[model samples]
Target: MRQLLYQLIFFILLGIPDGRCLHMVNFFVPEFANRGDKVILECGFSVNDREEELYTVKWYKFDSRGKMSNFYTWTHSNQQPKKHRIEGVKVVMRESNQNFVTLKQMKIGSSGTYKCEVTSKRRNRNPKYFHPNENPPRFNVIEEEAKLQVVELAREPPEIQGGRGNYFYGDDLNLNCTSKPTYPPTTLTWFINDNRVGNSLIEDDLLYKDDDLYVTISFLRISVQPNLFRAGEIKVRCVAEITEEPIKASMLPDKKEFKLYQVKLPEAMKLSTQTIFDVPLFGDGCTNKLTKFILVIILFLNFMF
Candidate 1:
């Protein structure tokens, strides 16, 4: 219809008839933004008419609930509510909405559907000998939509819930990993000595403390062997990774890194003197008199010195 309208106007302006030639152009690209990131949404259009025209651009927001509201409008200047406040969000346009509108300090609340409608109306003059019914006027309308998702960065590292323990041989170690609630939720994994805990049975649980927060707790139970760690310590760590299922594939996933937890190995039982004593290292078989002999020898040596 736009091409037909252009042809009709051209024929009338030049006082000639040509109905086969027409042209149209359009461009559309969606926008993506992260939480607290500065974003720019673009909406551009073109017209083939040689006559003077007027273009109007309006930007609307569709919230998470699917509710839509008009927020900003531009004809040649700003024409939207001034007193209304959307936290840390603003729209900047130059040359037109052709360049795009900026959203500053974007937040989670800034997410949703952003609709930009560019409508161009041509002011076609009626030829002196033409009738209004000869050509049905056409108007240009282009609507582009972009969905913005504000992803919150993971804040808290995964923490061990219970305190340190005295794990001994044949003991079953139960480690609880809890990560600070995060957007897009998080998966908890247990690691021992910088390796994933693969030999244990793990149970997962989730707790919702806030709308933006989704906490996950994982219980890892593994058999402890006094042989595996004879003396030093056992190092365990928990990693909380933001699942990409909730976010688009195009966006980067967030993750939290936690420091390792060092659990000291239990001390070995002391050997008692009664268990083995009075045993001579050198020439004696039975040492009942060796202690006395050794004591006398040490005393004589000291006196001589």
Candidate 2:
């Protein structure tokens, strides 16, 4: 019986192949996290079908300066690090699973490279005396390092309702500037001819609206002559601050900057006489009436001549 036991122990200590002993490990979280936001750090092993002996998983963090230090060390025992050692950080490990560790409530300080180390045991001739594996030993496990990134939350852009339309002189032009749903909402200002309009000038203004999230809208109106079109070079712009630039980069199939649309007068207009030609009617009722009126005026003048 003793000989049988000794043979079994010899095989476990020296028989297992060396090359397959320790597997590589790596960690990954979302590429970005806002400050004071929740982030998850996952630590896992590269080896598939690893023996149950691999239980201990250690997770550590490094500072922005690239200095690495221990943050979390977990084992089957219920003991955990003192609250003072790891502030604003929490970890949960599952023994029921293959020893997966999840770190949460991440802060800016939590940003850094994280590593997981696992240790397994090899049975010896003496079961209780079973020694920790030495050849493919405690130090022989895989190491995977993943970098954590922290970012600031982005502010929402203000909303611009309705677009610029043709208006004759002395016509009431009502313009509204509304703020869109934003994280850390902001106030809006209405501008006419590059001048800020006062609250008294606003025809209808409500500084705040009742909604789940914070929002505000301002409305302003002014009467100006059509010739002021030069001044009404209207551009409604909404600006927001974000950690990421909103532009999406796409490569054009061809290298040329093509003009997709060119503004040209209609073919019929080109054929019309130079004397105050009427605009050719296209679609809808209101436009047809205007075109007919202009045509009648042109015909009347030609008849009188």
Candidate 3:
């Protein structure tokens, strides 16, 4: 009894008649689909009264700007389906009928609200078969609508740039994370030692590609501190995510590590002010051979003296 009451309330909410005449039974539309995929839209109905007969079925689409257009239609008298030419919508006539329509190679522009209208007619009780003055049949129409979103996913995980083999304390670390081209660019996040980093330490950018695709890039910068290291290393991770309706796609985080070493010097002997310089080492060339020769001569002269 409770289920029946719920059904009645649902019908009332949808403004559908509760009688056994002509009514919609079910409607199916995919909530999400990947780009370059084939999609099918279905509409089902039932007619219980013998006097009522199916009249016409039509499909319409609403774009992002809320513009409506009819894409397909089928009439019961002709028993043939008709397709209207529309950008980003390719109808497969061989696979389409009064009940369903097939879209081939759906693209990003295909993301929109789709509506199906079903119409039925009730025959006149006092119908004159050959009289031109008879009144037209009464038509009852029912419609249902749903939204679809088409998305393109990245082909590979995010790549990290500007990483070094090692790091020193009190140094500034700057890195960049980049994601491949995809529709509706991905969001990037940074982590250090399994802890999320604050937004102040990160910067984001997007590069537009052809066909409504984009590349996402994120930059991370932070000062190195002793507490940021664990087991003599610092771990960095970057995750790329795409959020869409009814589904979400994410790739495995890209990870990197930098070795950290402490300066081994006595506190008392360490200078209060020091200037560190990076000196280049000489290779095993003519200069090195000349130095070796001079060293040998000095040793011989010292022995003779």
Model number with the top TM-score: 3
Q: Which pairs clash (backbone N, Cα, C closer than 3 Å) in model 1? A: none
Write candidate 2's Cα lDDT for 49-155 as tens digits: 34334445566666656666665665544544321156435564442133355555555445556665565443233456554564333333555676655432324
**lDDT (10s digit) by residue, model 3, range 1-305:** 99999999988865543334777788999877778999999998887565678899999999877998999999999998999987778999999998889999988788889999988887555565635455665788889999887767765678888866544555568888888776655677788876788999999876655655667788999877768766755678887766332222233223333121121222332222111112123323455578779999999999999
Q: Model 1 misses residue 237 by how many Å? A: 2.7
Per-residue alpha-carbon lDDT of candidate 1 for residues 1-305, written as tens digits (9 for 90 to 100):
99999999988978542231221244343344555666766665555455434366677788756877766676733443221244435654342344366667776567677787776554456656555687655556667776666655455467776533354445566668777755556677766655566644788876544334456778877765533342355666677766544322212224343221121211321111101011112222234357668989999999999
User: How far off is residue 157 in model 2, in Å?
Assistant: 2.2
For each candidate, what TM-score against the reference?
0.57, 0.42, 0.67
Best by lDDT: 3
Give me the displacement of residue 205 in model 2, in angstroms. 30
Q: Give the TM-score of candidate 1.
A: 0.57
RMSD of each: 15.4, 17.3, 15.4
Q: Candidate 2 clashing pairs?
A: none
